[model samples]
Target: MKARFEELDFQQTPMGELMLRRRTEVGTGTDIYEVKLGEEFLMSSLFTVAEEQMATLGLAAAAGDELDVLVGGLGLGYTAVTALGDPRVRSLEVIDALGVVIGWHQRKLLPVSPALVEDPRTRLRRDDFFAVVRQAPAADAPRYDVILLDVDHSPRHTLAPSHADLYTAPGLTALAEHLNDGGVFTLWSDDAPDEDFHATLASVFADTQAHVVDFDNHLTGGTSSNTVYVGIRQ
Candidate 1:
């Protein structure tokens, strides 16, 4: 099974020990993939409906309030790039825990997305996502109007157990602290949400809703169901 480019096998990730590879076909570059635990499919560049929707919904919920945005994950840089496409966005802070992923985007992966990787309004931060949220200032002015998270497959089933904190009571409070008045938060999960995650959102925001979107993934030649949860800070 040969594609235009070869899979670049690398280190293990928190989700599982995995290899990174690029997919190309018909002399055109496709996207990248992370093969987890040698069998489970992780993320790929082929389908990005959920990633794009996360940003789109977040911005719409913000209702022109978000000048600066903080995206919790930098997967394929889709959400970050999509948010940056908006002229109203003054700044973007993209936080990812894995420095290697960032390195790949800066080096091996930039050719596929030159414009997004080199955007002037973007700031890439290498740190644990929750820590960044916790450190956010309590002051009103500097808060992020929108917070978009695409870091995990779902709240119930996470790649990292430590991430559960982000869906907990204290975590919800921390996230709320960083949100400006009437701001919005969007979370993307590969699958449906569990009851606890749903309740957690209800506990955190004034309004909450689950949105389902269809995805046509080009890499695997399959259709997948993706869901997003939206929370508005009252």
Candidate 2:
């Protein structure tokens, strides 16, 4: 039997102190991995239904096979790994601002980390995803069929002030340019769907929708909800 709880790794990032931890579930004996940034919990293995749904909802919006996908955040590899599960996804590029977090995956410290590192179609890039989307893609740059973003808390709540622009019309327009015609942009928001943000997405995409995803919150003993916003590029 392994230790019931363990601190896997710790790092000081520009964002704050980041820690990866594993705890054994008492009733089920399942090992749950968790990531914490500063005083806030970023992600947990036990509550990954919404993360997986982000990729599913995004890819479902994108039309056609041989899809090239880009994931704006790579927390614990849930979003990227879920996107890769689809046989239609030809390629996947995962961009994350935190290099230390990427290192954890490369080191196989996370459960799905090995899958991400070993996957031929997946490429993990350490960079600001918002910065990548805000600029026009070079003539030779690859356009994505789907872009799944799980970086911020929501359109109104971002980790940093700099990330606020991506939720605006002009910022979304710039992101649209990085997608192929009919490409999909999906966002994972911790809050309920915002009407103003929906209007912003509608202004940028040909079609848009917000899905309220409900999941079991073990800590709360009740259901918790998150939003997945999907938009199809014109």
Candidate 3:
């Protein structure tokens, strides 16, 4: 049987309006992305291995004396909800540029089972991710033990082209500012980043490494693998 998709309902944002659709196979897709941001694709359900890796490995490495987390995009809220499951996590904040996507979670279109939204530990912010992260306090700054960023596609290609800047030296530097000592910054990518990009991260971070997770399930046409990069702030 062929896959099915419903027409996306749109909502406004600082960048522009974004359209999202419901897939019989997955949870939802942003029309502009043609990319599904839920499990099977983006991991809407906590059952997905990718989300599990994002939360478990990413958060575990970032954990410290006291835990706080900052997730770049809300998507299906799997990353946020999964972080909440950790007893060490004292606070969790998720920011997404598209208000409509966040609204869907509010309306329960996505099952955030751990209940991060209602949990006192979680704060959902609908704002420009760059602005939010940059302006976030440095002194009283929410020094996140973990910062899991899944904003764009990857360093090679991105869902939002403008976000290419976030992968740059300056962007990575700004991201570093939010981290407490020993904090880990992990980013999920559809493909491996160019060699120089990794070098850029190494300049700002004491330790950095890339991990690849294979997903034989073809979304568009051919087989594809995913990579996530972890950068530790010393």
Candidate 4:
């Protein structure tokens, strides 16, 4: 039998210690890929339903043939790859604060790295998504049709405490300015549906919806759930 566990890479970033690992399940023999920051688990291949849904549901809300998408956080490249799967997506700019995570994809360390690099539509940008949104747009700044964020654990819970502002009214207003008219903003949350966050989005966007995605949890042997919050620019 193949080795059950392997550590692919480890590095220290401004946020914390980031590690990429791959493990094979004993019973099911499923090869699972995971990324962790410090002691917290950032992402796992075992649960990506909500990630893909963030792309599909957000893009579906955008009205246009050629769409430009901005995906915050490049964890495992699941969300970015899912966004690229759509033919309507003309360009996909994935922004991640951690350069180590971006290097994993550039070095083809992860399984999806090869595909992510080969896709001409996708561009990996090493920058803080929240800071970029807060900044004033350049004269020729490219407005996106949809912005999908998965960096924070949730609106209330964040990897960095500073990220909490991004979900507030003022922060949402700043992000909305970077979107094209009627563009969509979507985010993945580890927590269940949050009415307060939903209200915050509603206050900024014309329409908002929260989707509860359920998937089987191999660790707990039961179902797990996540939330995908989507907001449309006016």
Clashes of each: 0, 0, 6, 0
Note the Cα lDDT for every prediction shown.
0.78, 0.94, 0.71, 0.91
- Ranking the candidates on TM-score from highest down gives 2, 4, 1, 3
Deviation in Å, model 1, residue 186 alpha carbon = 0.6
lDDT of 4 by residue, 1-234 (tens): 678999999998888788999999888988999888888787888889989988889999999999999999998998899888899999999999988889999999877888898999989999989899998789799999999999888998888877888899999999999999999999999999999889989999999999999988867999999999999999
TM agreement with the true structure for every prediction: 0.85, 0.97, 0.79, 0.97
lDDT of 1 at 101: 69
Candidates ranked by lDDT: 2, 4, 1, 3
Q: Give me the runs in candidate 1 sitting further than 4 Å from their true place.
A: 1-5, 12-18, 25-39, 108-112, 135-141, 193-195, 217-222
lDDT of 1 at 3: 61
Collision count of model 3: 6
lDDT over C-alpha atoms for residue 177 of model 3: 82
TM-score of 2: 0.97
Deviation (Å) of 49 in candidate 4 = 0.7
Which of the numbered candidates is closest to the native, going by highest lDDT? 2
**How would you encode candidate 3's per-residue C-alpha lDDT over 66-140 as one tens digit per residue?**
698889888767777877888888888888877777777776655562486679988878877877665546576
Candidate 3: segments with Cα more than 4 A from true spot: 1-8, 12-17, 25-48, 135-138, 218-223
Model 1 — which ten-residue stretch has the worst lDDT?
A: 28-37
Tens digit of lDDT per residue, candidate 2, span 1-234?
699999999989999999999999998999999999988998899999999999999998888979999999999899999999999999999999999888999999988988888999989999999999999999999999999999999999899999999999999999999999999999999999899999989999999999999998878999999999999988
